[model samples]
Target: MASSASSHGSINAADHSPPPPPTASAPVQAVENNLLTPVALSSVSLHGAKNTRRSLLDHVFKPLVRESASADTTFGDVLARLSIANQKLARYDIFKEDSIRVFISEALEQPQPGLHLDCTNLDVSISVKEKSRLVLSAGTDFGNAEGSAYTNAVIRNILGGAETLSVNASTGTRTRSAYNAVFSTPVNGNPDLRLGLEGLRSSTQKPWASHEEQLTGGNLRLAYLADNGDSHALAYSGVWRQLTNLAATSSPTVRADAGDSLKSSIAHTFTRDRRDRAGNPMLSQNGWLLRTVSELAGWGPLRGDVAFCKSEVEVSGAVPVLNSIRGGLPSGISVGGGLRMGVLYPLPTGYSLTGPAQPSRINDRFQLGGPTDVRGFKQCGLGPHDGTDAVGGDVYAAGSVNMLLPLPRAGPESPLRIQLFTNGGRLVALKNKGKAGEGGPTAALDSRAVVNGISSAVCELADGLPSLAAGVGLVYAHPVARFELNFSLPLVQRRGEEARKGLQVGVGINFL
Candidate 1:
């Protein structure tokens, strides 16, 4: 009985001996150790920084560490938090490239064990290389209006505060010359809130109207980003505008409003973009944009020479279609559409208190047509005309529908496609003849006579129906720009309006 008991005790002792050392993989053991051990962040240091204030870095990274574990945090948790902090620093645009390197100061010679375990108190060091702070560049750009050359100098990270200052000058065929200076900064050190100020002097010629306009102005802007990735901006601008060099063929309305004018206005814009890319649209991408603007000029105590209120709204969107045929050509197709409408009304007090109330100025009226508007007509061709020049209208409406299809033999990823489209629009002038208190031709001419004369003039070239056009085009969409050549034919037209029957070339960011 004693021998049996001794054998049993030996067996129990053998059972109690340490099982063989774990043969599990290194990663498994590391994970186990990370789950078991507690670690604390001892210190953090930044290296290779010049011109950047250390306080700014502290402001950016300190918040990330505020919630870090005081006692129960594991090594893995500390490493993860450090990695996240590094990513946050990269978003400042101060770095050149993969600009962050994190390491333990004491474990430089043995990184593997430091990464897995063995370090209870961690001292993390971050190294970053700064990007170039000053840049000077000159380039040429072409648009639907004409070609232009520009030069600009930019200073970044100004005063170690990540602000921007820029000076630019540009000249084009139609736009004679322009100079601008701009300064921008983050508001209250919050990257999402931006404030900017800009001053500019510009002169432009309108060949279609046979006139030139000179403008000098300055504006202040504030922009903020919401949590849903939408952006909103508010701006105030004060400008002096003068129309000169009017040819003998200039429209009467143009001549009336051709003299110098002062305009002070405030505007706001909101944009919500959810597309996969801003420069190019993909079949899978879906997004929409809406913009509304209201401007008051020469109204109230600070009223200027001109008095009018203009309100405009525009909306555009793109959406994927025919998704069931994933392997066919329909997979690459999308539908896009947009609508634009605007109205201009006169401010009564500004003119009533001053001299004779003038009509809304030609410069502020709504003009429609051309490649950017209704594609089958010349620029401003859909509206009222004074001789050969478009006098524009007080109200305008335009809309378009397009089906974007991939061209045959083109790869699925190609940016080239065929666009089948139909667009239409109309513009009408608001007549002000018989409203009470408004001055009309004196009682010299009978009211019937005046009305008949006005009716005859309007009926001579009136557009009873909205201009309609249908066509197809080849669209080459680049990351930064888009170009198209459309073959459009007008289905409906006005009596005296000029319309383009054949191919029309367009260049801009989008069809709408």
Candidate 2:
């Protein structure tokens, strides 16, 4: 895909630094004076413009999704009813500006909405070389809330693995327009340690403060690794970012491909308390962890994370022995607390680290699925408590999957990717097997989401299998240009309905 996230800002023409530190969390190739200086459009941009893609609003989108004027349906009915006879996917254009339109649905085209954006651009310009290996990406994001901006880049796949570096950048106001190359050479043919830089420069748009705000800052990152073809791998990264009118957000986790063994994991993020790079505010918090398996099998590919969360946050972080299984429980639970901030993907205002608000889409992650996380009942989650007396920590380990078959060929730029998938997860407290349906003893955690206080109670009282939903949508291929139309879909329906009304569709970049 030729970079699609609206290129608004100008690029910086100067080469500010040598290649970034071998391991910077997220490094911004220092901007000269951090100034908003306008310059002539880059020659590369005119080349891009000449080759610009046709608008998605034209032929392709119209034929893909359209309006069916029904004799029996009102605008509301037409909005509520899809062709499947009473089964409606979503409402349309609840609000519309001259160039923008919207849709609302409970479920996405199909499939589960994982953590990362599915694809960066509607045009699929990136592909693995061999199709045998899955490329894992690690790096940092930079931005400035004081200005408006956009950026785009590509990842080259070697042997089906993402192993090359490519990029494009621009600010909203044409203040900067330059591309910085880092880690140009594929590191040991390993996609895990791939170097990628994502940043933003946004200026406040007036009259949006009530609904949206402005934020400007820069975020950058570098990641690389050496893949030995068999089991061993080495990877690292670092990021440095500042926000002018910014909002805080949750922590991020680096992921591994499915079925691949040979374990390795080490990643975390840091933030300053202030809005800009200058140190007017205190340091908020930081996160880090490392885990390597002596033996890959049965180790289950160990994973860990530490984060500086919001003040409403109860706790965060874990101790070393926490991963050590002693009598079936970790030695200790992670602990820390204070007013954590908010950082949402594809933020609402160019200034804040905001994501789509509550009524729309939710892409922020709190904790993994388990006892303390989503507080409910599922597979085999029952065990004893090991948390501190005051901390109130409980344990529940679980796993689940969701699948879907596309009515269409799954391709890179096809705006509509649909399929069906089911998901499941469970966590058990080695000591206490809480009854199903009853939830737990406490009113807060002890609700209907729990087991009836016994085994078999899990399936007996429930209406059907342990299934909820999986949502999907489009994400501009580039990482820095936050133009994500995050979406989702629901599986089961409500009473008197053969299908489900549980579906929810909003605009946010939360799908994995």
Candidate 3:
């Protein structure tokens, strides 16, 4: 029998074919392989930066060009250098977001006399659109426990070298009226370093202490970022503070410190933040943070009405309990904890013969409890109390532990989460054994007495269980701030501490 096939080719019954491997384009392949073809940078040109100084551009790009223009330089090296330059420009905040464009082409001529013939000469061009010179904004804002209406104006590249001038004014329930002006510029055209001068005037209400304070001040500040991504700031401030508007029920402690005081102070602040989500600093699914502040007032040559040394430290960390299995969302639980501590030590501006030194002032002391700090307690509630007023403290310690669970349908990326938290703290006011009679105040405290008081306060804070609270809350992480609503109760509390029961609402940028 002869089997004849049709016009079409015969198909095999068991034939199988697999899809072809993906083919990437030249640029994609180059990036994947980190293209190392020998190249040299011949020239670089910048376009569209009208307000930015040419010297600033030169300062930023000179080192990059020098590094990438070598005969042995590769295409990858040039691209990396270009990226670094772009980042520097972006950090200056002079350009619009994502408005920078880079173009690269083979150079028509090789300028180097002894250049290698085998290496390709390339030209790089960058175009950037500067942001608007002036920005004005007005809005209503909510802070820790109060709301305010504010106006802000900013002038970018004010003096052509990525300098900025900002003016702000606000009126609020707690902050009656405030005005601030700041002028800042990069040091030596370095984005990592900046210098600023600021002037501020404000009248603020402190109902927690039953007093209002008015301040007029100016400061000179230098800020820089370290190689390890830490940020640091050094500043000197000259402030005139007048404490007034005391409530009828204001405690004697508040009344005693209510007066005009001049503070000539120097301060240092250090911060390190490593969190998974940069967009919302309030809710971190992972990573750790640390911030420390130190201030010296009226010591040695620095002269001021008040004299003290103040230090504060805050540390927090978060860890994931599970990995995400969903696409485009985080579907895991996280646990976080935070600790904050502060101390204010009294210092004598000058030597005295007979009387003791003054104690830490209300403004210079540490205030411990608030929605942004130890929760479930009223604002400044964990501190030493005089009648109905929380007098703050000379030394304090606070901490919190929280478990965050993603909302059932919202997912972890939603910026909304369910939080279970416990918070506790202690605030102690230093006592002076050498008090002058029953009514009059001493000039200053003895050095030995101040030291002993601080030690005793620290020991008391560390000795026993702190005033504590526990609660469950709904957390919303807005770009500008964090908001929370919770029904909470105090689990452990000291006498005179104000504890909140039932539902409470909180709004702030930072939380314990």
Candidate 4:
């Protein structure tokens, strides 16, 4: 992925959900009071490991069920209420409502491909590489944070090696052909949920060609949800990944951009918090939890988690943060379900998520969107790492959280909407640099170099940071199409005082 184009053109990276419903107030307040869910839900994928539900609450309602064994919820009472809610559903099922009928059939399967398109303005644009990434996870199980569905490929220049075989593997196979070529995989994805491994093969003739990159890897993500009635829950997944980019060969750039990761996720309706849906798709409420995770062994200094996400939010659009850790895991679990928002905004004492409404117009300014979680410090600000700064990583990993909410007293013509958001993070710098003969992990970046990198990165963020961003504008929404525009004036600055900072507009997508 490249730097996002105009935020209002098509769909920029990072996805989003619906506007804040009145019901979201509870979760937002709970977060402020330190009672809402944590950040254990970002990694969960619906198609890499198991069957898919349509929403987050597909499995978040059951009792803790932990006889001290497998439980992540803190409020046991939520379980009791959950059961009551289920019992209340029998009547609806008897009434033959579509949603109720679907709920009764645990035999219900997952959904199919759902492709979309939206280009509201020049600032945002989004497109999909494929039509649908359906997961048929039936007789299988992935993790709780990641998932996969299709097939993909990646190639790396050994920085030098083109004459030697230089191939290694664990459970799968690897093959190299003429003119610098390599093929490896586990192919389609997880067998249970999908057809086969979701992977590919590659070849390159250039040596120091294009940064002489290494550590090549790829993953095909699959997502599915029950689209039978309404309030669909996510389900099943298929995943397969391979890492061979870190071949001993050196490269133009020290580190490789390939964040090789593969995982599958699944979510099912265990019960509901408000079961009396009355056949109203929007009003129907159920508790669910979707989980997916992927772990792949590697070939060199560039080894570790390739990709991971642990997040949870309300179907209504409020995000939950995971705070603690337990049961052999390093982080806590997200406890509820919700819509996926595109932006995380900071509030006075708390934070809020932001996203535009679907079938809406897109703006050209105040754009915000990109590859996200990697490279360029702007929007795509994250990369491969398990709490470690392989290259100028953040000590606390100061991640920026943005959210969407209704703007107060804004006119109908306003292109932007007010969203409560916050961004607080520590500075990051390189602790060590790679050596000359060595690549990525081999170089030794002394304190001087690390200090310099840190200062420069911080300065860049400071110069680009949008202070107290809260306003309204034309927003775009779609399964793929995405766009948003907002005005934010920074309140705290390290040096000067200039209120001339203009509005923020961003857009992104998987295809465009």
Predicted structure 4, TM vs. truth: 0.29
| lDDT tens per residue, model 1, 1-512 | 00111110100102112222323335667666665566544445566656675555655556544434344566676667777666556656666657666555332233221132434554555667777888999997666646678999988888776678899999997899989999987776566678999999999888777789899999999988886888888888899999899997776556766778888877787777666564354332357777777776776654676666778888888787777767544366788888988777655434343333345666677778887668888867787776787867767778998888878989546788898888988776656432222212211223343344335434433346678888998888766556778998998887667788899887655456
Top-lDDT structure, candidate number: 3
- lDDT per residue for candidate 4 within 404-446, as digits (tens), equals 3323454322333333333332222233333333233233333
What's the lDDT for all of these models? 0.67, 0.23, 0.80, 0.25
| Candidate 1 stretches greater than 4 Å from native | 1-41, 69-91, 100-124, 142-146, 278-285, 327-330, 348-358, 433-464
**Candidate 2 TM-score, true structure as reference:** 0.23
Predict model 4's lDDT versus the native.
0.25
TM-score against native, each model: 0.78, 0.23, 0.90, 0.29
Top TM-score prediction, candidate number: 3
Which candidate, 1 or 2, would have the higher TM-score against the true structure? 1
Residue pairs in collision within model 1:
none
- Which pairs in model 3 have colliding backbones? 356-444, 357-444, 357-445, 358-444, 358-445
Model 1 residue 213 distance off true place after TM-score fit, in angstroms: 1.2
Ranking by lDDT: 3, 1, 4, 2
lDDT of 4 at 101: 15
